[model samples]
Target: MTAHERLHTRAWVLHPDIKSDEDRRAAKPALDEAVALAAALPDLEVIGANIVPLPRAQPGLLFGSGKIAELKQTFSENKIELVLVDGPVTPVQQRNLEREWKVKLLDRTGLILEIFSDRAATREGVLQVEMAALSYQRTRLVRAWTHLERQRGGLGFVGGPGETQIEADRRAIDTQLVRLRRQLDKVIKTRGLHRAARAKVPYPIVALVGYTNAGKSTLFNRLTGAEVMAKDMLFATLDPTMRRVQLPDGPEVILSDTVGFVSDLPTELVAAFRATLEEVLGADLIVHVRDISHPETAAQAAEVDSILSSLGVEQDRPQIEVWNKLDRLPEEERTALLARAERGAGVFAISALTGEGLELLLQEIAVQLRGARHEAQLHLKFEDGRKRAWLFDQDVVREETQTEDGFDLTVLWTARQAAQFAAL
Candidate 1:
């Protein structure tokens, strides 16, 4: 190879299956997901992946010394330059393992941070990821640097122990955090203004959310006819994208494609991405796209639900479960899943890639966005011109007769709109 030629880092992925953990996911699928995550980074070449069963975690090295020796042999044979652990690793464990295996190490959180750093496109996304990474780094600074012995000049109030390396690093991170937060706040304010402007428009928002690589972007492209980045990769779409499209036999609506969720999404990320996820909160309807062919679909759905609930998406919020990737399944399984979906309300079976059953899904979305409507005759007094105007503005008034004391109107409106009118 030429000296200037780029080379991918040889990496191995390991998911530690802890027996004592009550919430541990199945080992094989978890390891598969981890391997996919490692491959998502352009520079990493995933050479091998395994699920390392652990009866109990060792404090110092995570894996037992015997198991560590075995892994080291395998890694050395494969020329692995990096090890990706699919779970939390303490700073001590990470340092010890790297020293023993003579390889760079990254825990699940660190790997995710790397992916987010690589995928973030917008200014706000970049700032949020940097802040979250700094927060994560602040927790693992002990012995990470060699400057702990040196001390800078302090404010001369005599101190027994002067600033250490970790303390100085943390202070530096705090300063950076303050700056990033300021920038993020400004960006968030601007986004809020944009959201408020969108609200003034007549289009309702429909948000697509699901586990990573569940075909959301494909569905989004099919619905909006915009060529977004749709690939069979984790987090192919990190920054949210929005487009306006008219639903068939329905009103024009804004379709929002959001970042896909994953099991055990880093807490720092959740906090950092709040500005992005606020779009979901404002959505009139949510479409959860699922890869129905996957073995862990149920578990994935639960994780998505947990994250949504944590985000304060109310149970009563209108939502549809879209069983996507129907074309990938065998005929027998496809029929079974479709039958099951038919037994539920607000559920759809479709192949977003092939555009199968999309018309039905679109029709359902239109119905959900419209909500329940009823025709009623409303009598408003002359003093209630504000209410009368609101009815007209909503385009719900069918016929009106102006009387000396009042206006008599026939209106078709949803229950929520009626309540708003009553409030007026």
Candidate 2:
């Protein structure tokens, strides 16, 4: 088989609970998204999907023996090679399911990890993914090494190779974890130095965050004229990219495109990606770009909000919600979206693919960046030429006058900049 065909296989989704009408209703969209994601791959096919309800007190397997038997037969008939469970399954549970169905079984976390591993491009991103995968695999090693039983020596102490294998695996994983942490720490320190330098220049940072394939990069390119790699695939842009964007007032701010968030993101990934996500924490403004055309856009928005809150960034910062891809919507739907924007909800209806409503959004961002401070006039002695030069370098000077004793200057700057001047 070719590389694509080797990775491609038939997938079946099994959601463990569909007990009520509401449960089934709520699960349909998630199942649909999973199927859509699966379909995006070149070789994967979704032959069958079903929701199984479990009664109280049954714990060994999610479904009863009868259901398992039927599922096995169905898997055989459909030639399904893999089962994707929507919920997390224990290593033991996964092993049992694979044995019972005679096929590979993966839980939601594993599937997401696989996608991330495939999509990661940068060395840091790949290292982070590898760390997360190792952390996940350490727990699942039981399934892979089950044949090696724990044997005892002559004196009933721990035996030789068997015990050594377990210890060696644990020690190797610990060593790798420490090395990854050290590397990540270095990256974090470098980022901190960069942030400090940017602070000295003091350009407002505007970060774009949203669900996967929500046109964040498209809008980012439209606003900043940057040619970042934007595509329709999930997790297409894993590395954060930043560009200097000039506002309507000619004041420049840095706009950053961050990795997109998804539902039920892997815990290890969240921890691993925290260094990259520090950009959001340092942002002056956040542009939340949503694919308003998606059926579950609201739920996806909630997921983004939840992740932001977890990052301790949901509050205080000014957020502009851009309802992107309006051109794909029906006329009435677009009108309603505009009505929502008119309600002073910090929302804008825009088509990033085309150049609609972008100017107004840029103007609003400029207004926010401008409203952050006041202008000041200063008089300095000739010996204070250094301070004048410093002011010119650090803050926006609106007006300047030179005299024998001193130089007079008018500057527009933040209060923090003014304080820095006073210290000078």
Candidate 3:
């Protein structure tokens, strides 16, 4: 059977300690993200959902006997071949739950990993996802390798066949993991070299980052006029795409579209994608695109901020909040948002799909970039022709005068570039 044809599953939300109304309210976004993910699965059907409020002492199964019985009956009635949990599950707990329910059980991490595996297109992306999957699977090796014992007899074994098979699988995975890491390291080094070259040219890097489906790719295409894959689906763009964009002031900058951050993103995937995310760390500015019409905009913004902080991108870098999709909002609400944005709120209300208020946003970005530029007057010895040529290539020289023993040049550059020039 085809992959889509064989794909069938049911999903549910189970929060163990949503004690207060506030806690439940906070969990609603996670539940929404889970439901959205399940709906995105081509062959999956969400036939049942349950919010189990089990105590910590009995956290293993995440449900009481009564609740388990109810879930089993519902699964049987709905013909659910797999169970997708909205939270992480311990390896033992996952095995036990699958045995009791007589179906496959995948926790939140596994589900996200599966989606990433399916969405990965480029070789780099595939390698990163494979590394993450292996890392995650290593912790659940017992459950994963238990079935290796059923292999047919092929050779005389001094050790038990099952033990040998398990050891072999573990060793193979370890070897593969090492190879993948090496490949990724090479890719990262190549990227670093490219970044260094770009720095020499010194085009301001503006990275677009936000929650999934917040129109980041759409805005990226709109700004850069590059047709990247922009869809309503979750995690549409896995690989980072960069294009040169001319600002309103006629200054050019490199705009990058990064992978969208989601609530409760798998830690393994995050760790794996660090190389890709390094772009954010090196950015001159970050454009945080938010779906202003979405009810969870603030929370989504918080999640993005948390991820940025974790990636070490929170060190005094400028961030512009672009409240996008204003076309979806009512006129009065949109006006209110715009008014708030106008009051020096570090936010811009725009519609990436419709190009509404984009000119103003571009002008704002240009203003920030202009502010980031620093002009320096340096006296270079006349014999230092190479340094003069490098400075001309590094930045735009506004003025230059030949002196008796030296040449005085005035150059405009970003602070980082200024440091590099000073080092020279």
Candidate 4:
């Protein structure tokens, strides 16, 4: 059933501010983020949210007994059906808390995994989410469901009526994970082959990446005229979408809109990010989009930079900074931001909705990628089906002709792609 048909799930959000030595975000914003995450799902109706301050975590219940009782009263008063903790919750803690509060519960990682399961469209995406869900289930071993035998949607992380509880079932989870690994391996190999073949296209890939709800998809749709989802929702753009665009005054290039990055991602969902990082790592130019109007835009940008650093994208790599959502800013601030953008090299303030400052951004892109690829023509024997297929897979063949002894084709490709094709 669709989310709209069912009664909305009343939920509460909490951010645990445990005592920490270093590197902790402000509790209030973290609570706000947790609430927003809950709001992302159509079926979730978040009625209450707060930052729960703790000196240290409890081994059994995650919260102190007093605090748990107090929160239980609050949950009962608010009729909270689900409790979303914006941090890790051990299996014991989860089970205890659920019973104590008489409500369903999802830790930070589990909630994100559920979101991924709901949104994953591609085969590889679905498999990755399922594998991550299984890995997550390995710890809980509670009533869990898997799609190992059926290629269906959802990982069944969300608990509801008629859930089963099969004790001592670690073996089932391990076996499912093995099968999922094999399936994912096959998908990845096929993906690798596609990427290798796609590299032959001389178009330098310009990738747009930023924090969720940063307007990357809006900008991508504006530039490419592709019908990519550009909602104001978090993680609205899940799959990496690529489109070819012919620049008005420059060579054609590939514009790729990748999955939006999230902050404080849990280790359990690391495999789910593989597809996103793969796209970013392969980009010739990275466009870091920022919602300049957001209060925590600086923190969001820092997280993006940190993730890129972890991906080994060097500091000297070609990049552009786009201060997006300028239309959402006040007139005075937008003007000031525009002025600042003009002063900074490779920075553009644009409102993708209104087409403000995009001309300059496009021109800058053209300048950056100028002379990056060349037009070439080649002739291959009829027996060279693999080479022909590889070239076609690259989407570089602009023209082709059948000849007496072979085939003639025209292509536009980068020198590196040409070398790889030659090696093939």
Candidate 5:
């Protein structure tokens, strides 16, 4: 084999479609998604992928003996060194499969963690990925942990940590876990301090969330003009990025671009990123960007909704739906979708790539974020000069009269602004 060929690990993707599994997706699309995940790994060369149909998962090997043998031959023929399973694999199954197929293997959770670790650009993001990866590895009773030489910045699963084989030492892993948690807590506390400081800035937060590769970063770049890495790949953005921008007709807001979500996200990641996602909870409004042209757009949207609910995002939060990627749709389909979006309130069909229909979408964002305004009267004491000044600075005060003790003011503001004022 050529040295260049050996540089990349030859890999294959397998999506097991168990008939008894209630949540199984369409086999072909699932296979496609698995292949896309393989392509996301730069050091992995994907030779092929398949959907292995099964009546039910076999306990010991995850597949029937005959099926396993058939796959072993195929992997040997293709010189496949790694296999990425599109669903959760039991620790025993993972170990047995590696032995049978004579190839390293990673399940859905491990693969996602790898992508996250690779894309993590911030200290907080890196710490969260490491903590999640450690927790995931601890579950594999027979799996080896390479404690040293961790400078590679990944979970040490592919080739790095897996190079050294050792007996499972739960106590060492626990100690490392404790250390990671301590570092993560320190980072989160600093983030909390920053968020608290932002609370005094008076600008509402608008968060953009959706399934992976859903053009959220594209829209964010177009709106904010920041040079964020916007790409046509899953898990492209792993860290939360925020910038302040003034809308065309809306109030100036803090726009946040968050990590894209995926179906059946690993529980460890959900827990680890909970603090990162907490920023979403404080958002006054959410913009749901979607790849309208994707075959599984509906299913992806459902998954995003489920994750949002799991993250404690309430239904009462104000939200707008941006059906992105309109340019990829057929003319007939695009026309029909445009009509549908027009008929639906708070929904806009746009192409963030081509800048088509973005104007109206931005206008709607301004409208939705403006919220409803109402009038209120309040009296402030002489000692509350800061609070009185804040009200005037927001431009919400319509009238003010000086009194002996303090001032009487009449103000018109939205509920969001009112809440910010109360916080002050």
Candidate 6:
């Protein structure tokens, strides 16, 4: 490649700290995360990052005129080719900013869409990303460019200007959205079939969820012995991965590693990826993994919980909080965290990277999954040997007696185990 072509695009990340917003995060960590997000995309050299404090956002340009002038001067001096805003930017604001700065501009949603576009691996993931990107693009088609107004000729039989360039483009996007929806529906149907198949075999599903870069993938790898992409990078694991793991002295479970949640995740993405996130919805237990070493661990956990709630996870769903990354904490802090975990029900402190406290965590998982056990009797026909064998395999059967037409077995099991046996 030529030197010119090889040069990475110079980019600056700006996280707007809105002073008026009571829920606004601290500026420094937010800016750091925004910079990391920018760095996740290929071919972008993040030269600098800062927190742009605003008492109120300007509707036309996001930043006030003075701040815009100052930023323009900084961009020119730094030879920046792109400005990435780490918050929502209106289409008008985006256009105005790009024109004034004479460089490309991408908002938080746009940047995330680009990252998802690059990271998607599976067919469903790709389709989901495309649908989300199109949804985002549809909102930005508000004459951001003069070219969108340019008209093209249609069939001679048609009337005036056919449709405007913008109309044709939007219609094209709508058509593609429809096509993608059809393909995605098929994929979702296939996924449902797989879910049903798994239900028959019915190992309890344990889902791992957390904020981005919270070592969920690392923990998933350590627990399941699968080579999922685990990295100290945001959105490293996009596609949901499932593996069957047998707990020591306990029942086996299907462990699902899902996409990590982030604060202010794009609405389009949440909608498009609903089918994928269904894994979490169907989980028998939710493990909320946390990077306990991070400074904003509490805030991050809140964000994850908020997203889970938004996704319609019921309040009564069994959940365990895993305080991960203990190895990264200082000795005193680690000891304190461990002590705190001891006092907290359903909370465990561990380092996924070092396999610390995993044994206790596993035990807790098994205990939670066991639920409440009760004695019950099940009747099975001669042709239902498989069901009877499954009950035996689960070690839930207490006694059995053969009748002329069937076998009556008494079993002591939790409702979860009984449900699995029934599915068999």
lDDT against the true structure, each candidate: 0.87, 0.78, 0.79, 0.84, 0.86, 0.87
Candidate 4 residue lDDT tens string, 215-267: 99999999999999888878877788889989779889889998888897877
Candidate 5 residue runs with Cα over 4 Å from true position? 142-168, 371-424
Instruction: Note the residue pairs that clash in candidate 6.
Output: none
TM-score result, candidate 6:
0.83
**Model 5 C-alpha lDDT per residue in residues 261-380, reported as the tens digit of each score:** 887788999887777677798787899999999999999999999889988888878899999999998999999999999999989999998999988987877887774456789999
Per-residue lDDT, model 5, residue 42, is 85
Q: Please, what's the RMSD in Å of model 5? A: 7.8
User: Residue 352 lDDT in model 5?
Assistant: 92
> What's the residue-level lDDT of 33 in candidate 4?
78
Candidate 5 structure, TM-score to reference: 0.83
lDDT at residue 49 of model 6 (Cα atoms): 86
Write the number of the candidate with greater lDDT, choosing between 4 and 5. Answer: 5
Q: What's each prediction's TM-score?
A: 0.85, 0.79, 0.81, 0.81, 0.83, 0.83
Clashes of each: 0, 0, 0, 2, 0, 0
Count backbone clashes in candidate 4.
2
TM-score of predicted structure 1: 0.85
Least accurate 10 contiguous residues by lDDT in model 2: 17-26
Off by over 4 Å in 4: 1-6, 142-168, 374-424
Report how far off residue 195 is in candidate 1 (Å).
0.3
- Could you list the CA RMSD of all candidates, in the order they appear? 5.6, 6.5, 6.0, 8.2, 7.8, 6.2
Native-referenced Cα lDDT, model 4: 0.84
Task: State the lDDT of candidate 2 residue by residue for 1-424, as single tens digits.
Answer: 5675467698888777646334333567777666655554545677888767765314456568898999999999988898988767877677778989999998878887777777677667888888999899887774545544444346655554456776689789989989987887786777677775765454787899999889998998888788887777667677888899778765789999998888877798888777667788767788899999999999899999999999988476778998899999999988988888878667888999997888888888887777455667789898887887887665356678887888788776665567668888
Sort the predicted structures by lDDT, highest score first.
1, 6, 5, 4, 3, 2
lDDT of 3 by residue, 351-407 (tens): 999999899989888888875665778899988988898877643566799999999
How well does candidate 2 match the true structure in TM-score terms?
0.79
Runs in model 2 with CA error above 4 Å? Answer: 1-7, 18-25, 37-48, 56-58, 142-164, 371-424
Worst 10 residues of 3 by lDDT: 16-25
Per-residue lDDT of model 1, residues 99-144, tens digit only:
9999999999999999999998889999999999999998777444
